[model samples]
Target: MPSKRKLVAASAISLAIVAGVAAIYQTFGGESVTSSVAAAAPPAAEVDVAAVISQSITDYQTYSGRIEAINYVQIRPLVSGTIVAVHFRDGATVNKGDLLFTIDPRPYQAEVDRAAAQLASAEARNGYASTDWARAQRLLTDNAIAKRDYDEAQNADREALSAVKAARAALETARINLGYTSVTAPVSGRVSRAELTVGNVVSIGANAPVMTTLVSMSPIYASFDVDEQTYLRFLSHDTKTTVPVRIGLANETGFSRQGVIDSVDNRLDTSSGTIRVRARFDNADGVLVPGLYARVRVGGGAPHQAVLVSDAAIQTDQEKKFVLLVDKENKVQYREVKLGEQHEGLRAISDGLQPGDRIVVNGMQRVRPNDAVKPNLVQMSGDAATTKGSS
Candidate 1:
């Protein structure tokens, strides 16, 4: 027979064992086990989804460029003299033939007077010589004067006439120098500050210092380099028709100005594999400044059908770009894609996508390939939710 206390302790141990087995069975048995697993499994991830947008879009190529002035003039003095007066405010808009600076006119005026006096004296001498020559002709005809005297009178008359012509030429030169005393704007433009102020002496020569700069305010230029493919595709074929272009400043988000292709380089640069291109834009408001950074968009050829998507949906897979495609089963499938230039606010898909395909646009980082997702339909470009289901 067992002891009483030992029997009681054995009974309690048996009850505990029974309870443990029942608990284990409830957790791991048939339907119970299935229910436990079902409770533990996570729900499908929610993500923003939209169908790919397909439209006829112009194929545009973008390039970094610089704003330039169509006509940039460095104002230099044509005559050597002291600058007597500055006629324009710094950075002021000036018209053609507007006086920019005034040099001292006293010296040129004196030269003009001297040349005029010389011309007058030569004319008087020429008058007297003409009279003498007439008299000599009469004398020769009458045989009253020697032939040698008549010949001398004829030579003197010719000399006086030559002197008068020389004086007239000198007078013309003096008048031209006097006109140069007023330095005027050669073209309508915005003028820079005067490099040489009043009382500053300037000289005329090949190495002469520039007095100021003037740049045309309207019809500005934007210059850029284009690759060989772009030049061949859009520029080389057009012989007469103007190609259209657009430009955006550094601070702008979109291309706001419309322009036309102005010119193209004659030859390609073998070293750079590009050709220089220039476009002209109207700057009637004078907002475009030279040397500013510009984003040039060159569009040509014909409109073509393209599929577009938001940039947020793109993913980088090592050396390749990819996106998450949500099929009809709501399963995310990995898709590699080739990209093209951006149009409007969306990126154009050159390959690996088609119209009506649903793509994960947001929350891409939360899901993986083949994972089940709960897609929330939205616009490709906007944040507003839509009632449309995934395609």
Candidate 2:
């Protein structure tokens, strides 16, 4: 027979074996196991979810360009002389035909006086010759004077008339030179500083120095280059007639000024595979200036419906871009998407999404694929904070 200590040890061993079996059954047996495990699992993650947005979106192609003046002119002296007076202040707005400078007119005035005196002297001589010719004609008719004297009188009268015509031409030239002494603005625009100051002599002809520069202010031009593909697209649309364009300064974000396509290059540049394009915008406020850096957007295509989603919701995996989608059962799934141009802080999804699909816009990092989520459905439009969940 066994001792009392052996009996106690055997009893303890049997009880431990029974307890272990009971614990296993509770953990993996049947409905109790399922209920216990389900109770232990944590609740679904709360997330901000938004349906894909659908709208008629217009696409635009952006390019960096420069602003140019519609009309630019370099003011130069017409006649050579010392600048006796400056009629315009530096950087002042001037009108067409406004006096800008005055050259020394004394020399030209003296020439005019001299030509006038010569004309008067020639006229007096012509009168004397005419009278002599008349006397010779009468003497010739009477057959009392030599034909040589009559011929000399006729020749003298013709010479006097020729001298008078030459003097008159000289006087007209002198007057024109005198007028050139008063330099005038050739265009209406803001003028630059005077290149030649008062008392400085300026010369005319091809070597003449530019006195100032002027550029038209109201309508300005913006020039840019477009690639072969873009050029073809523009040609298909016939952009020159009514293609819309927008412009913004370098420091600005969105294009604030509107313009129209004015011209396109005749041929594509073979070296760069691009074509030159120009746009014209009204600058009535005179804020746009030449050589300014510009950001331009050329409109493309007609309006079409596009699916957009918040860009922040997109996640990248290696080379593939994806988004977290919430199904009807509130289960999260990974969806791959193709993207297009971004507008208003959202990205256009070209494929792999529908307008009615729900995407996890926020708290995506906290959820995993196939995980359940407590979604707060929100409208993608308007203020993000003000949006309320429909679910």
Candidate 3:
């Protein structure tokens, strides 16, 4: 009944229907369908990782302060007169008892000569009186002179001896004044500029004529202040003996010199709530000078061992500090931490960390907690390099 063309057309329709049916059947079939296409996911982002999690750290606090000298002295003239000559140049170093200045000695010398002449005259008078007394005594003993006359002669001789003793005392006083004319340095130190130069009149009382200023330099002092809390913290521990210290110029890094704690102020300042502490260092190199600002660090207590991380490695929230940790499966996790003082670029972790733990240092913003990521090798250069440690 059907023609050849119709038969061919029907066969084509049937084949199409049959294939569509097979596709539908496969979509809901009991047997599962398999395809080569994988899940459409975002590409893995590169990240930097750090494996060093915990370390030993000695906790420390910082303070700002100034420097001073251990032994500072102001030199003054003992007597008043024009400074005829100065033995030491301004700001020169001198030993103890070194001649510093000279005052005119002619005045004192004249007084000494006057006293000596008085002594000689007194001695001559005493010699004559002694002869008279001897003669009087002889006459009295022979019953040719009165006892009153002999007594008078003895009195005269005694007066002359008293005058001689007085004159000798005056002469000694003059000699002492003459010796004081030559001034001297009292201590061995580096002296400051001579406040009084040659021809500058100095005084005993008009004012304390400061001839020079001296400061002991071999063992100089470094003065720094600690806040009330910090001062108390160090004192609470047994620091009866010397505490350790190190110093450097304020702007310079790395404390280059080591010293010892020389003293601790007994009282805390009420106004500032800080206590002054001092350390003595041997400035043999003359590197440290007076009035210099320095970075001073004090060390104490038992050695502390703890987990440490770079400051950049740690993240801070409103009230807490945390870090991103990467697990073995390349998954990241957010870990909270308790932090102590930060020194240099590292922080002392007080809690919530351990050694050998891996952390995400670079690409932190790109990853979240429990994020699946691909950790690429961290190159030493670029913006992503924010202080990383080998994992």
Top model by TM-score, which number? Answer: 1
Off by over 4 Å in 1: 1-45, 130-158, 238-241, 369-374, 382-391
Q: What is the per-residue lDDT of model 1 for residues 129-219, given as tens digits with 9 covering 90 to 100?
A: 9999999999998899999999999999999999999999999999999999999999999999989999899999987879999999899
Q: Against the hidden true structure, what lDDT does model 2 obtain?
A: 0.86
**Residue 117 error, candidate 2, Å:** 5.0
Q: Which 10 successive residues of model 3 have the least lDDT summed?
A: 379-388
Instruction: Tell me the tens digit of each residue's lDDT in model 3 across 1-391.
Output: 4698899999999999999999897787634433212234576677887665354556566555566777788877776778898888777878888988898878888989998998899899989998998899889889998878888999998998898899889889988888888977777777888777889877787676788788777788888888877666664455624456778787776577777777789888899888888888888766666898888877666667876666667898789889998888989888998987655556677887788777777789998998888876442221234443443
User: For every model in order, what is the number of clashing pairs?
Assistant: 0, 0, 3
TM-score of 2: 0.76
**What is the Å distance of residue 292 in model 3 from its true position?**
2.7
TM-score of each: 0.79, 0.76, 0.68
Q: Flag the better candidate by lDDT, 1 or 3.
A: 1
Q: Candidate 3: TM-score?
A: 0.68
Q: Look at candidate 3 and give me any clashing residue pairs.
A: 54-307, 55-306, 55-307
lDDT of 1 at 373: 98
Query: Please, what is the whole-model Cα lDDT of each candidate in the order they appear?
Result: 0.92, 0.86, 0.76
